[model samples]
Target: MPTLQDVAREAGVSKMTVSNVLNGRRDRVSPATIARVMEVVTRLGYVPNASARSLSARRSNIVALAFPSRDAGGVTPMTNPHDSLFLSEVEAQVTQAGLYLMAHSVNSVESTAHSLRSWNVDGAIFLGTRADEVAALHTAYDAPMVFVDNHGTSPHISNVGIEDRLGGQLAGRRLIEAGHRRIGFVGPRFDEPGVVRERHAGFVQALTEAGLSLRPEHVVHCDAGFDHAVAAARRVLAAPQRPTAVFATADIIAAGLLKGFVRAGCPVPDQMSIIGFDDLEVARHVSPEITTLHQDIPGKARAAVEVLLTQLAHWPAARSERRVLGVSLVERESVAPPPAS
Candidate 1:
């Protein structure tokens, strides 16, 4: 519905300036101006004609937004608002760069390679992939690769991730400062490398620094959605010595936990307090506002695109770097001091 004129006006730049930025003519525009134009483009949801633009560029100018399959059938669902917002920003960048975007949900190395080679892909940004797997994909596709939320280190890969461990520490310290000791952590308590695992590790480290410990029984492992969150919370509720507070590593999970507590008649902040990560839209809309850790999805998305584009423009010599985004705490009505004995 929005046009180039709208984006140009919104970004307070000339039409030519907008065009230069959108067409990947980086030398003609300042970094600050390019960032400004891209932000406005995202805000206005400006989608240009991909076919016409790509032909003019000569390059296929197609970016692959890939992810590992969530289910057994190699289908990854893009159902979360956070993921949607992240993708929305990435789409903005892709459009600004005059590129066509393609999405793929791949489960195996073979399938992933097939998708990359099958399409006229210039670059790829993937979710939930490992460092070694990233290498494998690079070996197969020979395109610029950007990975999100992967904790494992690999020199040849470009990554955009949050300081998940630091976020956990913030949540744990906040709960401890609020006078909660018997804390329950809800999320997938896995030994594998990922955001969830890093957050749990940070939380445990924080507890250890404060002379507290998270007993194995206090850890509830579950998936990242609301249904799994409710079940995970219910497990904590059933524990012999119920925790006074629970910090679900994600806001979506916290939303579920909050609902589970209410459905089970547990008084929020009276019987239990809750904290969540990735301050989602639901955090503020819920009955009692959810206290959460905030991740700058837009900023992260921008950085991820910048990394990929830089690689595309200067590959074989471009630096394979990791960009770590910061996280902050959003205190609201959910957290409270431990209930009286």
Candidate 2:
């Protein structure tokens, strides 16, 4: 590969002048000079060094994607679709800006904080991590970051997420419309800020409006991975007074619920109506399908990247800078009115 020096020598211009032309910094150089530098660069097949360019601009040009884990290690299968969707969009947007993305998984505070600092990441986007965790990172590294599918108590952090509360409310209202008076919820019970809390809040809001409540025994809490979800679903479904309808907070848990129900010979919608969040592709492909709240993964990813890039540019953004994308209820074949006594 031809270097900037080689191009500069060929164009009879200083390396800085050649650089300004390649990186679109053309204010200092005249149009004729820029045209000359570009012609030489093309003739020499020269590509600018990204690291040097980023150093000159005092930016890393490298962002991170963090997935907070629990006891279960590795990427959660339930989260794969959501992750892939956002990553694909993130990668495309970052590439357009001449930047790159670094992906990491964090299961604890110590590891997450360590990775962020050690990696020297310019900025980060938390993928479905807790708001509190992301907030902690903000305090520790003081690095620019964007949160997706999470929230926090502080006003400083920028978060891009679907209206999880609205999603929950939609699911609850859908179940109510389907005549399910006795309802249940399945998800993590963490007090930290996150999608679970938002969706659950919405669930409670809608249930309250419908003169119903999520019975204590009916609400299931599991760790943030697969095995735990499967186990939790079994216990919840095995209860004597099982809920007529169950709203799983994550699509993965919902998938496990579907499998468990199948193994127990429990017909879906016929025995117990089901609803879930995230609108993962499997949510629609599964047998009987699933009624869910549609969250636009690509939109959230694009917004988060834009926020980080805006902050990277050191521009004045709106206060709080929070963005809550819209959500809509996806009606499918899974839900129905509870069986008459």
Candidate 3:
């Protein structure tokens, strides 16, 4: 209930000195004075007014973390392991940088722009946003913005993403190295212009180099959800000539496929092999731990936050930057040589 003025009066110091000490501008005041002011502040239980401080600093000290409510494939960002984990990491990094994160699931460019305008956010970090949506938001919002997992080509937009194509190639090569000739691919539509499309392209490249082409029926359209992947698994199982190995674009989908295969009494790696992308926690926890491509979710989160903060610090003078992290293959128990007839 005590105010800053009360603390200043009790400490026998000017309100400006108390303000400097409380705001961590300690260079302006002696250590002894800082200690004394802090002691009085603790004793008085005084709290600074956030609105007043923000107004004086011309910064809200808050950043927005926006992602689509449902991605192009109708997969909820929060439910997807990679997206959720990245969000957690971004929040942690933002907090460590002495800023607050406002995570929002955006449905449209208009709505997102309105929210950002209303909140007066210092900047924004977007995840799983489509290229078109990113372009629209960039034009609509004046604040510094950074995109993650977006394939926008604008020279002025900052972005952080992984080698999605290389990830797909790694997954495909692993299956092929394990002697899987008849293989299937599972993920969002391959035609979409995003991470999934890049990954699928890389997968096709690897297959073509090996003189093998993925059959149309073997390419399953499933989002990053348990039910969708489970249905895809059923379709794969019912095929007259099922693939010996399957590459799932996301770990969540792979986990669901594993569950579906179990329910159908299909033995993994013995009768069928599976490889997944994104070495998420679910990849290891599932039975016959999934072999997957390791994309650094934490690294991506760090880069996104760092880029957005840098833009915020430099404002209009900041040059846009793009960071593309690498990926690696993780061999696990889920993949093996094709079963002998």
Which candidate achieves the best lDDT against the true structure? 3
Residue-pair clashes per candidate? 0, 0, 0
What C-alpha lDDT, on a 0 to 100 scale, does residue 58 get in candidate 2? 46
Instruction: Predict model 1's lDDT versus the native.
Output: 0.83
Ten-residue stretch with the least lDDT total in model 3: 19-28
**Candidate 3: Cα lDDT at 246:** 93
Off by over 4 Å in 3: 1-47, 70-77
Q: Tell how far residue 313 is off in model 3, in angstroms.
A: 1.0
lDDT of 2 by residue, 1-341 (tens): 88878988888999888766655444578878877887887688786676776667645557888775533434453357788788889989886655678878766767777887776667788876666576567667767778877777677888887888989999999999989988999887757777788899999999999898888888888654556666776787777688888998877778778777766777788988989888888887788888888888898889999888767555333344788899998888789899886
Candidate 1 residue-wise lDDT, 1-341, digit = tens = 99999999999999889877776556668889988998888889998665676567534678888866675322236777777888889999888675667878767777887877766577789976765576677777777888998877667778999999999999999999999889988886566678888999899998999999997788888778777777777898998688899888888888889999988989787889999999889999897999999999999989999899888777657788799999999989999899899
Report RMSD (Å) for each prediction in the order shown: 5.9, 4.5, 4.3
For each candidate, what is the lDDT? 0.83, 0.78, 0.85
TM-score of 1: 0.83
TM-scores for all candidates: the values are 0.83, 0.82, 0.85
Descending-lDDT candidate ranking = 3, 1, 2
Top-TM-score structure, candidate number: 3
| Tens digits of per-residue lDDT for model 3, 222-294 | 8788788888899888766888889999988898898888788888978889989889999999889999999
